[model samples]
Target: MKNAELVVIPSPGVGHLISTVEISKLLLNRDHRLSITVLIMKLPIDSGVDGYINSLSATATPRLRFVDLHLPQGDSASQPQDPSSKSKSPLSFFANFMDRHKAPVRNVVAELTRSDSSSRLAGFIIDMFCTAMIDVANEFGVPTYAFFTSGAAFLGLKLHLQSLSDDHHQDITELKNTETELRIPSFTNPVPVRVLPSVVADKAGGSTMVITHARRLRETKGIMVNTFMELESYAVEYFLNSDKTPPIFPVGPILNLSDGGDDIRTKQSRPIMEWLDHQPPSSVVFLCFGSMGCFEEDQVKEIAQALENSGHRFLWSLRRPPSKEKNKMQLPSDYENPSEVLPEGFLERTTEVGKVIGWAPQVAVLSHPATGGFVSHCGWNSTLESVWCGVPMATWPLYAEQQMNAFEMVTELEIAVEIKMDYFKGFHGDEDKKPEILSADLIEGGIRRLMMGGESEIRKKVKEMREKSRVAMAEGGSSYNTIGRLIEEVMNSIA
Candidate 1:
């Protein structure tokens, strides 16, 4: 059991934590000699997120252990005002937390390697946000792998764009003065500039985050991404042949389908799942944004109106936007009660056709036989889960690199239908005036196209990709070989 013990540290976010845990599971699933211990960063507040991680860790077999690394916490002023909200910005605040605590993590690694002789240090597999841990692995002469929890196209685009930032005189992560589209090697189509992540859109603080990631990822031994080769072969092949990139591995579609967590079921998931169980096969479109995704009151009403007009079966998870006092970062607004916000008689009129919950069990909902399409914010995890479940999507990205993910899914991959790709960009941070919201007509059109209209080809394409998603993780498949190769490389270094 002590022969090949690997250590992984994940950033504090639940999404990152979940992906890292799944990756650790993949690494030790079939390898009896391998064991893993995950060092989780302790956040400042009692958000229940840490408790969720603890619960999942408890369920992991004896080979996997999760421990909290007593690292320094962020200043109270810097942390989110809402203790329980999952909408913390991954790039800025979390990055600062990791940067501040780097020395503690390094010291921990050094101590483990120095004291533990029976168990060999396989390497440090860290969240991309937690890239500081890589230096510790290097200092102790052990390998480190960056665990990218997004799609490979995005990873390839990141590397390609980073190279451009380095070689070009201008900051490529920032939108150039006249730039309308970005031409990345990983993507065949030129992506519209308006849809890039906040890293590209905001050139000040966000630029530092993007540029820093570009620089740090190159320094790791290799990268392990949460995608399979079949879904991202075009980008994977590009990375493999490029002299610029380190070795790349596609060891995912690392999915966590369970609906349980720390004894909290989000209160609304039960009725939603029960409602789904009674629906006809492949008849419902499930709409959910990630923890961070939400819309203003008008936007929520517009979405409700659109759902009313689409005439298709639907399940929409709504969470109210953090109240102004609680919206510390002034992030976007989320909806809570669909019926309360809907036009009078609207909820009753659509009651038979659609079900709206304040929160839904996303993975379980997506995997259900009744769900045929997903209306997503395109957070990488949500995108992968939809694909892994073989559900097609209607893309409606709200923030961060989600627009980039939406662009990849709709244009680069043809698996999703785009509704309002760049609708709110101009108004996102603008304080003077109200932004033009996406209207019901447009949302209705997108839902119609995605669920029952002319987008049969997209449905078919997603179906095919879903099959490949499964195949890639099977024995002798692309992901299997990639993970095997990655582990072999790590084991060889220690021997």
Candidate 2:
């Protein structure tokens, strides 16, 4: 048996866990005698991630297991001792929240390393944000590779800033005091202060600490990202050229991790897919905001009206309406009826046209033949899934790296149309137009463009990129070959 063991400290988020699972699966499929253990604050169970992992594990063959590590009670969620929490200021409230989990991260690593079974440990795959693992890996004398859950473009920014903290701490402090664009080394493209990743931009102390710790990644054996070379050629080239950074392995377009079986169908997912089956090819629009996205009641109502007004076949994922009781989140008045989140008489009016669900199997929806275009928040995973499925996007970037991903998709890749823009910045300039936020008129225009409006060229481009992503993931293509190489390297490497 080709023996190797991996310890992954995945941040407790669906996207991060999904990526970690994929890397572990790739390792196991390569025939390595692997003991893959995942450490987390809480395993998603019930309606959360635990259910998803359980579903995946039931079918997994062997050499793979999801391990749950319990940390101090405060490591997860701490119960508020009393109702006086209402009196606390927002900043202090958040600080207390973040403080609780800080210790558990370090504690988990120390506990894991000291375990008797860890003798066979070959390396550790730590999420880039979990910088403490660098110390743990160093103590165990094993190679450490950072797994960036996000894209290469974002990683490029994080790692570049990290390098600045490492070599030119003085310069960074000086630059931060004034409002100036921090020119990332090797990236000729300028990134504005506001456009930087949220973690790096928002936290003064934490940002510096993260970047300083991030420098340790360069000293490690390798760095792996969930993106492909062709998709991020320049960024990948820059990393490889950087003497300070380690070799980057772009083994991504990771839809395989999302894949279960060609025939796999869930009871909850069946009704939505069945409805799509009745729609014409390239005729339906798949609209979904990611898990964290939400809008004011008015905005939600406007969108519901627009989808109703579009008269197009659509499938929309609606979040459970928030409760209006005092001290509770409130849903829009229109969503008060629960079923009314669709539209007044929407299900009845569009019975032949639309399906509204709290959550849909998005990847399956995107992959369906009827799904021709997507109206989305431009999340990285959603964007990748849409491109992989060959469905074009109607970009509606809500926040964070989403805006950057939208620009890359629409401007750099020419795969989709950006229908929204920040109107505060005059759109008359040479800079690309912002995608229209999901307003009623903008939503209608976006849906029409993706369906049958004057966007055939963009749709065609998306189709071509889709095919490229497929070929890359195919039996002997770039991603396929890279995955094979990754398996061989991990299996043959020494502790």
Candidate 3:
């Protein structure tokens, strides 16, 4: 069992890929006896994952390695095209890719097994989206685990949904159609169905996909979550005691030690870093969305108007939606001159107080001493990064599970202030053409509260959570021991 190897196949997105890679790193570090090989597929547009992977591999132990896997493409004409939208929906495309590529990926796996007899396949751990690969593991008579990207609360809720699938009760489909709150475990307050991720709230038949995915998770060897036991004691407890659940590993708050590792951050960080140096400690609020944090033209204008009104020191990383060819979740490049769409003279007027950059070196910016608060889209990864940096947030969830994440941060954790709580992107219809629901006044108020300490009383809370995250990853901490427990379980099973 010492050299037993695990195969990891991640979904084709930067968030999933990076988190999964981090898990691989933690696993290898925890047990020198373990080995891992990651199978990857490419995103149509680059979001720096390739470069990150290269750097990781260069420094990675010999026990850990990666290989690229290709998926066959289906007809483009058959794809769903949301006209008037700059970013095309990637859901169907990925779903189709999974279906078409499953066979070939299995063939590759079978061949890899034949060639590497010494490093026997111990098991498979895959992104929730790559559930199809479970079949390949089953075919090879191996166990499979699900690497869920979100927190334990989300998983507890998903397990609840799975149990609701029996007779006399409805499945996720019926739950989506209802107007009641869901009684999910691990969270104190009842969650409004609308605030739940689209899988349970999507009116567009998308919940059906989520339901299917949740069902698939039930069949895994276990589901690994990126949260620590301390941060989610309620959740870890709930799942562990729940019936019909697999082993739950709260193996994170897995901190990324340094950011600004890629060439992109290095090239773009000079100006942003310089500006941060001039500011007072913990004074500036940095506004950035995750890779996909683009706004409609009017929304951008509203944000500009709000910043001018707030009169707070700020650095806004404004982004436009990429053309159909790019990764929607990427940080966007800003206007060399932002005055192009700004209320005229907005740049010069706020010159002393605010700076706008296309791609503000996020990790660098967030980690800087001057950044105190974040106006964010509340992507889970970005949320974790902010917590790790000890910065508080004003949450603005746009799409996907962002709304749910926003809710968790604000209501559940009380670590963030809510900007526009009930907002849903698809509800506006013709997504890109959707009107801005958040007025300048509302945005301004949220910023003021976060920066000035109103109900956005996040300064003390975030600092405490940040320290918890650090301790949790340190020796003898909850996360560190969680990894050890997981390694022992895997070893015992194979032994």
The local distance difference test score of model 2 is: 0.65
**What digit string (tens of lDDT, one per residue) describes model 3 on residues 1-495?**
446879899987566888888889889987788888888776655667787787675576778788877654554423334444545445565676677657767877788789887777789999978887888889888889888888888877766776676423665666554678877777888988877765464455466567678778888988888887766777889888977688888878754555526666677788889989999988898998776666767777889999998888999887665554543333455566666767878888999999988876676788999998999988777888888888999998877778878888898888999898656664223253454568899999999888984423578889888899899989999888878887887787778
Between the candidate structures 1 and 2, which one is better when assessed by lDDT?
1
Query: Model 1 reaches what TM-score against the true structure?
Result: 0.90
lDDT of 2 by residue, 377-397 (tens): 787888889888888988876
Which parts of model 2 are misplaced by more than 4 Å? Answer: 43-47, 74-119, 163-195, 203-206, 209-213, 256-265, 321-343, 421-438, 453-455
Q: Each candidate: RMSD to true structure?
A: 3.6, 6.0, 3.3
Model 1: pairs clashing at backbone N, Cα or C within 3 Å:
295-333, 319-335, 320-335, 321-334
Shift of residue 226 alpha carbon in model 2, Å: 0.6
What TM-score against the true fold does each predicted structure earn? 0.90, 0.80, 0.91
Error of 1 at 439 (Å): 0.2
Best by lDDT: 3
The global C-alpha lDDT for each of the candidates, from Candidate 1 onward, is: 0.76, 0.65, 0.77
Clashing pairs in 3: 291-329, 291-330, 291-331, 292-328, 292-329, 334-358
How would you encode candidate 1's per-residue C-alpha lDDT over 1-495 as one tens digit per residue?
347778898877577788788888888876777778888776654444566766775566877877666643446424554534555543456666777667767776677678768778888888887777777778777777899988778887777666777777567644734557777888889977777775564554566667678688999889998888788778888888888887888898888777544455755566777888899999998888866566666887888889888889998877665555443444333354456666778778988988777657789899999998899888898998889898998888766678888888888888889897764432133322455788999999998888875438888898898889888889988899989998778777667
Best by TM-score: 3
